[model samples]
Target chain A: MTAINPVEILLVEDNPQDVELTLRAFKKANLTNYIHVARDGAEALEFIFCEGPHAGRKIQNGPKVILLDLKLPKVDGLEVLQRIKRDPRTQMIPVVVLTSSKEQRDVVESYKLGTNSYIVKPVKFEQFIEAVQQLGLYWTLLNNPPTGGG
Target chain B: MGIDFTNNVTAGGHQVADQLAASFKEISDLRAALDEHAIVAITDPQGRITYVNDKFCAISKYSRTELLGQDHRIINSGHHPKEFIRDLWTTIARGKVWKGVIKNRAKDGTFYWVDTTIVPFLNDQGKPRQYIAIRADITARKMAEEALRQSEARLQTIVESLDEGLVVADLRGQLLHFNHAALEMHGYSSLAECRRHFQELPDTFELHAMDGTVWPVGQWPLARILRGEKLHDLEVRIRRINEAGWERVFSYGGMLVNDATGMPMMAIVTISDITERVRAAAEIRHLNTALEQRVIERTAQLEMANKELEAFSYSVSHDLRSPLRAVDGFSQAVLEDYGDQLPEEGRRYLQSIRAGAQRMGALIDDLLAFSRLSRQALERQVVNADALVRAALEELAPLQQGRRIEWRIDKLPACQCDPMLLRQVWVNLLSNALKYTRKRDPAVIEIGCQTNSGSRVFWVRDNGTGFDMQYAPKLFGVFQRLHRAEDYEGTGVGLAIVQRVIHRHGGRVWTEAQVDRGATFYFTLEEGITL
Candidate 1:
C-alpha cells in the first residue's frame, strides 16, 4: 500500500488526556504519523470544510478517517456528524463515533446518522488506549476508504 | 156657766179617744212591713240572736227555736278573718251600721253566701239596744263574675305568648287592639309608639311576597275588611327590626273583629320570621350546584388520564417492538451469512444475543398484557371456584405432563365475581404451584376453601421450593423476583397480574411461606373477610 497522507487520521476529542492517550496508542501501533487533532466540534468542522484559519486548504484533502466525540461545546458532535453526512464532499468519509454514553437510543441514533462504527469509550486509561489502537489499525490498514477523492 | 164647761170637756175627751185608736192600727201595719223588707236578726249587744224572722230562719236552715238564744257564733262559717269579725262587732256595738258579704254554713252543712247589712237600734241616749240585719243571696252573681274574669285572663295570655303578630284595626284603619308581638313586629317599644291610627304608621316600609312581588297597603287586611273581602293565607313579607338589623317576616291575615251589629268591623294580621329558613334553602341549592360541578371536573380528569395511558401503551407496543425486531433480525442475519467462517465462540455469542432479544420480546408482551388488564371493563358473573380451578389446571396440564403430583380439592362455594378475571387469577396461581414444585419427586398441591366466620376463603397450597417469608412483601411486585433467573424461569409478572385482577373484583390476596417447605396463597373475593 502507498503511504497515507499525514492528515488522514483526524481525532475530534474534548479531553486532553484522551487525545494524549489516543496519540500514544496510534504511535505504538505505527499509525501516529498521519494523525491530526481537533479539540472541539467547531475546530473539526473548520478542518474538514477548510474554512476560517484553514481557509486556503483544499477540502478534498480532508481526513480519510475521522474519530468523532458526541459531546462538545458550542456545536454538538451529532449536528457536526449530521452536516458531514449530508454534504457530498464528506459523505463518503469514514466517521466513527467514540462516546462515554452507553444509552441504547444514542447508539441506535449514531448508526442511523451514517456513522461507520460506534464504540463506548472505556473508563480505564489502559482499556481506552487499547480501544483506540484497535480502531486505528482497523480503519487505517484493514478497511479500505473510498478511492474517489472529494 | 156650769153647762158651757160640761160641753167643752166632753168634746175634747171624745177626740182624744179617736186619736188613740188610729195610732194603734198604724203600729201593727209598720211591724208587718219590717218583716217583709228585712232579714231581721234582732240580736242583743252581745250578738245573741233574741229574735229572727221566718225568712231568716229559712235562709239559715235552722228553726227559730234553734237560733233564738244562740250567739251569732252558731251560724259563723269561719270564712271571715279574725280582724273582720272584730271590726264588725266594734261598729255594731257602737250603734253603727256594718255592711259586708258573708259566707255562712246552714244547719245541714251546706254553704251560702249573702250580702248583709246590719243596723244597731239604740235608745234616745245613743246606747246600743238591738241589732237588725238585712241579707240577700249573692252566690249566683259572684260565680258569674269569676267565670268572666277567668276567660279574659286566658285570652290575654294567648295573645301575649303567640309567635305571630296579631293586630286588630277598624275599617277606617284606626288601630283598636294589638298584641305584644304586634308591637315588636312593627319595631315599636309599645303599641302607642307604633301609632293609634294605621295610616300614621311609616309608609317607608315595603311589603312584598316571598318572590319579591310588591303588595299594596290598600290590599292589606284592614283594607280588605273595609271592602268586605275575606282573605285567607295570603303570604306577605314584612321588614321587622331584629336585634341590630332588620329581618324579613312572612305573614297572613283575615278579618276577625265584628261590630255590635254583627258586621265585620276590624282586621287581624298574623306574621312570623322566615329569614333563616329561606337562607338555609338557598345554601342547600348552592351546595348541590357545587357538588354537580365537582362531579363534572372529576369525570373530565379521569377521561384525560385514561387517554394518556392508552397513548403510552400504544407507544410501548409499537416503538419498543421496532428496535427489538432489529436486534433479533440482525443477529439472525449474522449467524446465517457468516456461520461457516465464524469461530465457535462467535456463534455462541450471537446465539446469546438472540436469546436475550427473544427474552426481551417476551417481557414486552407480558408488560402489554398487564397494561391491557387495567383498561378492561369487568364482566361480573357467578363463578364456582372449584370449576374455575379445574379449568385452569387443565390449561396448565400440558406443562405438567408425566409429573407425579397430588391434588386435593375441597368443596368450594359459588361467589359473585368476574369469571374471566377470576379465571386468570386461578391460571396464574396453579401454574405457579406447578412450576415451583417441579423439583420435588411427588408434588403435593392442595386446592381448597375454608369457611371462616361469615366468609369463604379459597387457598392454593403447594409443597414446593418455597421462598423466605422476609421477601413476602415483594412477592406481588412486578418484575421483583426473590430467586435468581437461573434458579426460577419466570417473567415475575404472573403474581402481579393475579393481584391486579383480584383487586379489581374488590378482593385481596396474601401468602404464607417457609424456605424449602411449602407455600400457601389465600385469597378472598370480598374485602376485609378472611378464612
Candidate 2:
C-alpha cells in the first residue's frame, strides 16, 4: 500500500518524559525509523483512521507498528485498541502496550483487546531501556507486515 | 314316733300318750328355728302355692291371702334367663333339691336378691308331691360387687384410649397390663408378643442410653421402678432385636404404685415417643454449625478481596516510581552530557534534584512493601531467635562501622514463627535503634527473651533518642514520624510493617520510652491461638 507521507512507527503517549525516554531508548537500539508521536489515545485513533485533524493523512498509510501507553489523557489505551482492531483499515497494524502500571486487570484487558505485546515500564533507567529495545527490535525488524491495501 | 293312732286304739293308751307328747315338743322346736331365719313357702303339685310363713309374707311385701294361691312366678324379677328358671324346676320335678341365688321383685315394684333353696317331697311313686322354697335376703352384698366391677371397666377404657403408653407391672416385674400405645411403642402390632414379664423385654428389644450404649435389663424403666426408684423424664433409645436398623427414642416417667395399706403393689410407667423431637434438635444444631462455618468462609473471602484492591492501588504507586525514574534518569543525562558547559553550582543543583527524586522513590517503594505485607500469606516455622537477630545485625553491619558500640546479646530460645517476616521485624527495630542513638558516645543495645505469664516476650532495649510518651500511640501508624526526615533518614513505614507482621502471627507489639533516655520494644508471637 502506497500513500502520501507514509509512517513507519506511531507512538501514543501522554507523558512527555516517557516519550523522550522511549525515543532515546529506541535510538540507542539503532532503530532510526520515522516515528510519529500522538499525545493521547484520541489523536492516535484520528491518525490511524485519517479522521478530524488527521483527515489529510491517508488511512492506507498506516504505521508498521504502534507503541501504545495504557493510561492516556482523553481516550484510554483499551478503547483505542478496540477502535483500531474493529476497523479493517487499521486492524492489521501491530499494537504493543507500554505502561508503568503492573495491574493485572490492565494487562488482561490490553490482551483481550488484541494488543500484540504488553510491557511494564521498569523503574530503573537501564532496565526500561533494555525492555523498550527488545520490544522495538522484535516488532520492527523481525516481524513482517502485510503490504495489501485495506 | 308318729303317735300312731292304731297303737293308741289297740291298748296301753296311757303309756303311749307320754311318748307322743315328747315327740310333739321336738317337732315344734324345729319349726320355730326355721321360721326365725328363713322366708319359707310351700307349693303343691302342678306348681300351685299351698302355704306360706309370716317371714315369707314380710319379705315379699304381701299379705298371707295375697300369696297363698300364687306360684313362685308372682315374685319373679325377670332378671335371670329363662333357662335358669327352667333348670330349677327340672331338678325339683325329678325329686331332687335345687339351690341358687335369684333376683326377685317385691310387691312394691322394687328389686331384691335372694339366696334360695327348694326341697321336694315325693310320694310313693317317686314323684314330687310338693316343693318347699327357703330364701335369705342378700341385696346389699350384690350391689357392692356390681359397683366395683363397673368402676374397673371404666378405668380400663380410660387407660386404653390414652395417646401416651402406660404399663403396669407387679413388684416382681411381672407384666400386669400395658395399653395399646405401650404395645405399639415396643414395635408390636398386638399385645400377644408383649404380654410377658418385664425381665423378658430385653430378649426381644434392646434399650440404649443417650450415649448410644446398650442398657442392661436392670436399668430398664420397669426394673428401676420395681427397685423403688421414682423416675422422671428418663429417655432411652429402643430398637427391636429382629429389626436392627429401626430405632426410636422414648421418654419414660414412673413410680412404684402402692396398695391402700402402703405396701408396694405394682410398678407403673408412662412413656412418650420423642424420636422426631430428638432428630429435629440434632438437625438444628448441625445447621447452626454449618452457618457459622459459612460466615467464617465469607469473611475470609472479603478480606482477600480487600487486600487485592489495596495491592492494585499500590500498583498505581508502582507507576509513580516510573516518573521518578525518568527524573533521575534525565538528570544524570544532563550532568553526564553537558557537565563541561554547566557551572559548578548548576551541577550541584542537578545533584540535589537527583537525590530528591531518589528519596521519593524510596518512600514509594516502602509504601508498596507495607501494603504487600498485609496481603502476604504468613508462612510459619520453628526458627531460632538468635539466628534471626544475628542475621538482621549482619545486614546492619555497615551502619555499625566506625562507631563505638556495645552489644549485649542474650541467648534466645527457639520459637515458632514466620522466619522471613521475623527477620524483617528485627532489621527494622535494630536499624531504628542504631539510627536514633547516633549522638551517644557509646551506644548500648540489649536483646533478650523474658518469660511473662507462660508466653515468651522478645525485647530490644537501646539507649537512644526516644520521643515523648504521648506520641506512643502514633508510633506505629504508617507515614507518622516523630523525628524530622533530615535527622531520621527514614520513610516512617518501618514500624507499621513490623506491627503488621507481628499482628499476623497472632501477637502484639508495644514500646516503652522516655525522651533521650532509652526505648525498649516488646513483642510476643502466640500463633494458632488468637487466629
Candidate number of the best lDDT: 2
Candidate 1 at B406: error in angstroms?
A: 2.7
- DockQ, prediction 2: 0.18
lDDT of 2 at A141: 42
Candidate 1 — what's its lDDT? 0.75
Q: Write the per-residue lDDT of candidate 2 for residues B1-531, one digit (tens) a residue.
A: 111223433434776766766665776787679879988888887787888888888888989889877888999899999999899999999999999999989899888888999999887999987888888888898888888888988988889999899988877888877898998777778766676887877778889999998889998988888888899999999888877558899999999988899998888999999999999999999999999999999999998998787856645564676778788879877887788899999999999999999888777778767876776678888888889999999999999999998999899988888889999999999999899999897999999888877778889999999889999999999998999988878889999999999988889999999999989999988844311
The TM-scores that each candidate's chain B achieves against the reference are 0.72, 0.53
For all candidates in order, state the fraction of native interface contacts they contain: 0.00, 0.29
Please provide, for model 2 over A11-96, each residue's C-alpha lDDT reduced to its tens digit, 9 standing for 90 to 100.
Answer: 89888887887777667656556679999989998889888988888778668778888778899888999998888888888787
- Each candidate's lDDT (Cα)? 0.75, 0.83
DockQ values of all predictions: 0.02, 0.18
Interface alpha-carbon RMSD, every candidate:
13.8, 2.7
Alpha carbon lDDT at B402, candidate 1 = 90
TM-score for each candidate, following the candidate numbering? 0.59, 0.47
Give the 10-residue window scoring lowest on summed lDDT in candidate 1 chain B: B1-10
